[model samples]
Target: MQGHTPTPVFSVRDKRNLLFIILGLVPAAALAFWLHILPVFQGLYLSLFRWSGLSPKRKFVGLANFRALANDSLVWKALGHDVYMVVFRLTAVIVLALLFAGILHFSSRRKQKIVQGLFFFPNVLSVAVVGIIFTFIYNPSIGALNAILTNLGLENLTQAWLGNPKTAFPAVLFPTVWGAVGYQMLLLFAGMSSIPKAYTEVALLEGATRIQEFFQVTLPLLRNVVKTCVSLVVINTLNRTFIFIRVMTKGGPNDATEVLGNYMFYQGFENFKFGYATSIAVINFTLALVLTFVVTRLLKKENLEYA
Candidate 1:
């Protein structure tokens, strides 16, 4: 055994495989650090200071931004708007997507693809485009919505949807739900397709109605997929509603449509309160992370087993 190296716990081949795996992951890890992780840390660091982000002047005012945000009424109201959107979007999208997914799941293969495409078409357009299109539709002077109402002799129902605080947020929610439901529907449909037909057939054989089977069998089995969809919707509603709101309302009509993301943008770019905006961004990110974690844990389930 003289001059011999001890046998490694991992054989050469195993070590080679491990090396390859590490190499494969290195690029992705580096890219993530450069793109996502680095900016997050930068934002957090910037949040502790007062900076206009237009000059080299960065006054280190630790936690002042956070304190300011805590006392700011608009921040709280904006977050409340986000919560409202999360709740409304979660309810409307899930219900409608699930309903449509169920219908698509049971339809003929050819017809299902066509209908699914039609539903998903909206998702293909940029969010700004959808917002702009809806803006025209809601234009009181000559918008399609009011024009159609007038033609139908329902002129009393017409209002400047985006200009009225009472209707602005709800009108915004309509397009938000419409644009999102299709993708979630397709996700749920795929989940439904993965379930064994035997489970459904067995339920039917036992004289279970379709509704009973869905509730007792399909929905229970689709829990994991539904959980994913819920988390996605929550995160998107919290972090990505800015574009739609910006294009449509600009958080206007007395700030009734203000949400966290839009508020962050308004402060950072419009008001030159970059530090305050970064703090809001931090809060937005935290809220999304916490809510997603809470939702996932709430929906945690044991894996389904089949004999």
Candidate 2:
């Protein structure tokens, strides 16, 4: 007893397991702190100060930047545009993806794989690349779209799609919709695949058509997946507006297509209003957080169990 240690409560294996668990958590904790947590706090701090991102001194301007943002009609308009874009994106992504996913669900296994790959192809590319490709497609004079319109004798329909403020928002949004729908379809199909076919069979046996079966049985079973897709769509609509807007229109035809992300970029890098930009970033983050919270709560379930 004098020289030997007392009996340990945990065996060597338990202690070793605990050590491994702690070791596993250390890297993740460090990454979360460094990559996400610290940056958010730093952005908040910088938002209260005027720094061009180059100056040695950061002049503390208090809430002036945020106040300016609040008063700016353009900023408000940009916020409105963000909402509009999200609404459109959310609707289009869901309707199209869900429809196609349903179709793919019933397809033969071989055909399903081929068509699914085609649908998912767009999602694999970077948003900027898609934007660039679509930019060419929308070109009025020699673009493929205009050529098709001309060939079909619908020349009036083809204009400078990205140049006219009236057409710019929809034009830019088209590519985004094209790129986003596929991934959501994939998710929905995956969810559908997990569903037990017995439910569908039972519904069918009870005089349920394919449509009826989908509505009564499939949709209910896929609730969690649908909820998840909705959340992802909301999030994507918020944050993923950046690369598309930047590459395609650059928040142009006279700010008609301006969304929060590009507007923030225009403020920070182009205008050198880093403080103002940081304020925009803060507001963007806050709005995204609030919306994401609402979505999660709205989709929250008592239990996923279906027996």
Candidate 3:
């Protein structure tokens, strides 16, 4: 008799487990596509029309909104403010966070936890709350900052922090840096902690000073984390809203503090120019995408392993 053909082994349990995971993920994937991705595409489509947000009629404008944005001086000004935020506010936050992370990495575990919590405390509060708090802190007449300045005999240096055009942008940016530095610090600290202790110990044995070890070894290994922190801060600064501008200035003192996000809001909700607002949204999204891609690509080219 011919040898019986061997039956292939099939594991029902493995098949069932795989099917269950796929089934569980389907709803989440669908929800994400519907809620986040669809609105972006819809905004892109709507940007080619001229329609107030509540208008029943929509005229096919064919890039008129984009053309208008190109010619609008206010748009340029708002873009400048956004760039300032990235350059000034975001840079300060990242640098401060890195410094704090380095200090914490060298501390005892208990002290490290306490310091980390203190740094991150601001991030736990809602943006609105932080905005309100800072608003009071910067109040021209009664704010804590000005009060302290007056008591310290620096009355000449004190001015309407959030009301004056000269100080408004920096005043608004201060709280943003305060609120975000902790999150970035934690990320950097985690990255620094993961570096092999043997490397540092060897360097110390060779009589390398703390500053020398930091510059030669710690900074290089922390490069990937630094890149990530910079990217996060840049994106956050670009998209910041509902905090500094909302509570402290409201893009006031003649729009001195207006960033792209607030500009888009004013166009859509305040001005009722839905199509134009959508166009602005598209531009902001495009800018963010381009910046993120360029930064990530440059980091990768430098052989910084983010993971």
Q: Pick the candidate with the highest lDDT.
A: 1
Ranking of candidates on TM-score, top first: 1, 3, 2
lDDT (Cα, tens digit) per residue for candidate 2, span 148-211: 9999999888899999999999999998999888899999999998888887899999999999
Candidate 3 residue-wise lDDT at 38: 93
Q: TM-score for every candidate vs. truth?
A: 0.89, 0.88, 0.89
RMSD of each: 4.4, 4.5, 4.9
Cα lDDT for residue 122, candidate 2: 92
- Candidate 1 C-alpha error for residue 96, in Å: 0.6
lDDT of 1 by residue, 34-121 (tens): 9989998999999999998899889999999999999999999998888788889989999999999998877899989898999999
Per-residue lDDT tens digits for candidate 3, residues 68-176, read: 9999888888888876777786568878988898888778999998998888999999888898898889898789999999999999989888889999888888888
After superposition, which runs of candidate 2 have C-alpha atoms over 4 Å from their true positions? 1-32, 296-304
Q: Which parts of model 1 are misplaced by more than 4 Å?
A: 1-32, 301-303
The order by descending lDDT is 1, 2, 3
How many residue pairs clash in all the candidates, one count each? Answer: 0, 0, 0
Tell me how far candidate 2 lies from the true structure as C-alpha RMSD in angstroms.
4.5
Error of 2 at 150 (Å): 0.8
Q: What lDDT, from 0 to 1, does candidate 3 have?
A: 0.82
Better of 1 and 2 by TM-score: 1
TM-score attained by model 3: 0.89
